[model samples]
Target: MRLGLIKLDHQQVSLAISKLDERAGEWALKCSTSVDLAFPTWESLKSQSLQAFSPPNQAYRVRSRFLSTRQGCLTCLRQSM
Candidate 1:
């Protein structure tokens, strides 16, 4: 799965994950921004794999913080399960 994050505003960010399609040569939507943050098709997440070459400076920190928080929450949830 191909994951992405887009900063919408100061308080919001749009996060998504799509399936890689070799035939279509584009990502197919697997899941989108949701409260549960579910991605059924997601296999593994690597730090380097998520990095962007050149991203908007203003949104970088916001996105990073959001993702970091989400990752922490996910880790907690998994441990509880």
Candidate 2:
């Protein structure tokens, strides 16, 4: 089950987990960011990266992958820079 979902602005987003407290069982969370790698540099690349990911499994761990444009997205917004 999902706990919380909040969206800010300009690709700013946050997520929260609840319910399954620390007493329920073992749970692990992971976050990943993907960027374009067309340019000489992965960030400078004037392209978008689309990747495939697998779902979280209880037998292994729970991980979430998202983009992070909060830090000004400077690195990713360079484009032709």
Candidate 3:
């Protein structure tokens, strides 16, 4: 997917999306007064979110909190109390 950020009047911005191949890699294109680039997403958003907590201490804390909430949600879904 391609995401373009366009500048409008008085500091306003706009986003444009286009479909493209992931293997094509990243791209930068000039649009009038601004440059636009394509942002790529991995296969799993959850894995991406987990990776965002980089520092060991922070990652541990966040992982614990996320796992607890995820477990609760799974239990609720399974109607297992």
Candidate 4:
């Protein structure tokens, strides 16, 4: 299945789309943002990204206080997808 990967580092967050290789138990990165996101831009990016990167019947793993702030967004995104 395809997976959304959100990586949080000090003052920035990185987003990536990956495909999980069930047989190999590995994740292969498909695409990612070139720019790292700070708090000021995280919201817009998160919404736009979730919509664009998230497809139906897939999973996500977001790691960051920034993303965590909007739990409903994540849940809704999952259900919508």
Please report the candidate that would top lDDT against the real structure: 4
Give one digit per residue, the lDDT tens place, for model 1 in 1-81. Answer: 123343332112123323334532122223335423432323322221243223547477876665556454485335557
Best by TM-score: 4
Residue 23 shift from truth in candidate 2, angstroms:
7.5
Whole-model alpha-carbon lDDT for candidate 4: 0.38
Point out where model 2 deviates above 4 Å.
1-5, 8-15, 22-25, 29-81
RMSD to the true structure for each prediction, in A, is 16.5, 18.9, 12.2, 14.2
Per-residue C-alpha lDDT of model 3 across residues 1-81, encoded as one tens digit per residue: 222343332112122213322422122122223322122333222243345434658867876776566454484334544
Q: Work out how many backbone clashes candidate 4 has.
A: 0
For model 1, what is the error of residue 14's alpha carbon versus the real structure, in angstroms, after optimal superposition?
33
Q: Each model's TM-score, in the order given?
A: 0.20, 0.14, 0.21, 0.23
**Which runs in model 3 stand beyond 4 Å of their true positions?**
1-56, 70-81
Candidate 4 wrongly placed segments (more than 4 Å): 1-10, 14-40, 56-81
lDDT of 2 at 53: 28
What TM-score, to 2 decimals, does candidate 4 have? 0.23
TM-score of model number 2: 0.14
- In order, what lDDT does every prediction score? 0.35, 0.26, 0.35, 0.38
Q: Rank the candidates by TM-score, best first.
A: 4, 3, 1, 2
